[model samples]
Target: MRGRKTDGDDERLPVISIVGLGPMGVRIGHALQAVKTRYTLLGHDVDAARVRAALGAGAVDRGTWSLAEAAAEADLLFLCEPVDAVCATLAQVAPHVRPGTLITDTAPLKAPVLAAAAQWVSEGVAFIGGHPIVRWPTDGDARPDADARTPAVGDGGGSVAAPPAPDAGSAAAVARSPA
Candidate 1:
């Protein structure tokens, strides 16, 4: 039967740390929370108040004042600091960070952040750049059924298209994995 064909699937979500608990950081946390399968969220900031605010907002499961504690256990660390603070924060935190983790910073100016990421490269970790084209207010949270699907492109015209429905196995992967 069709029902009997689907049973075994358990994909663990990676531990994610958000370094700056600003608006973007809050939104990222909200989106990951909306996905709601499993993940350990470590959030930190130099401001003790921001740490408390993120925890109070339910944006992070745990909040720490120590950057070292946040970086040690994360599989991916998102630096959400202000444009000017990104490089300085990286300089302080990069040395103690774990290998093989994905490091991303959300500074408005790309050039400086890019240069800093390049300078702090380690053997196992990958430094990538990310900027959210869309912005959200501090009070907002991600919609629970936000429909996070990639749209396909139409060939002849400028119209957008949708991909074919994935199989049950692929559907399970999409449900459990982080974007």
Candidate 2:
């Protein structure tokens, strides 16, 4: 986030931060990069290796080891850790986040995550518990229950396909969460 663009540099471009560089997080970084929208991408993770991978892949513009520091720098902060770690991570970053920062997550379960985030909701800050539901077509190998599914990391291929590039409207869907 050290070199992230400021208003003087580019007012229209946003400074985005991803808090966990694990699978979903890194993929998200990639997706954001693939989009036409202009934004600065920053990433962090407990496992430094993940952050390195994200940076090497050009997913994030910069990677930092500090959670709170990243939170404070973000205009849009994404919680990319596994569901189990979401609550603790939320606690750590909440106080440091700039007001009006829109925080979202890739955690599968929204109810509990939203409930945990509910305590932090305030005037300018908003939390949206979101996950990209990776749906497989119905077939013998189908797992229709989205909640029970885990992300398929590798399919013997070296990389996973990024999600379809999001339009500006889709990315602009951040609003006050019902939490």
Tens digit per residue, CA lDDT, model 2, 1-179: 23265556544456799888765676667657766366789898888887777788777888999988788888888887777688778888878887878878877666667666766655477676676644333453522122112333221212221211233122333222222
* Prediction 1 TM-score vs. true: 0.67
State each candidate's clash count: 0, 0
Q: Cα deviation in Å at residue 68, candidate 2?
A: 0.9
Q: Compared with the true structure, what per-residue lDDT tens digits does model 1 show for residues 142-171?
A: 331122121111111121111112331212
lDDT scores in order:
0.62, 0.66
Estimate the overall C-alpha local distance difference test score of candidate 1.
0.62
Give the best candidate by TM-score: 2
TM-scores, each model vs. reference: 0.67, 0.69
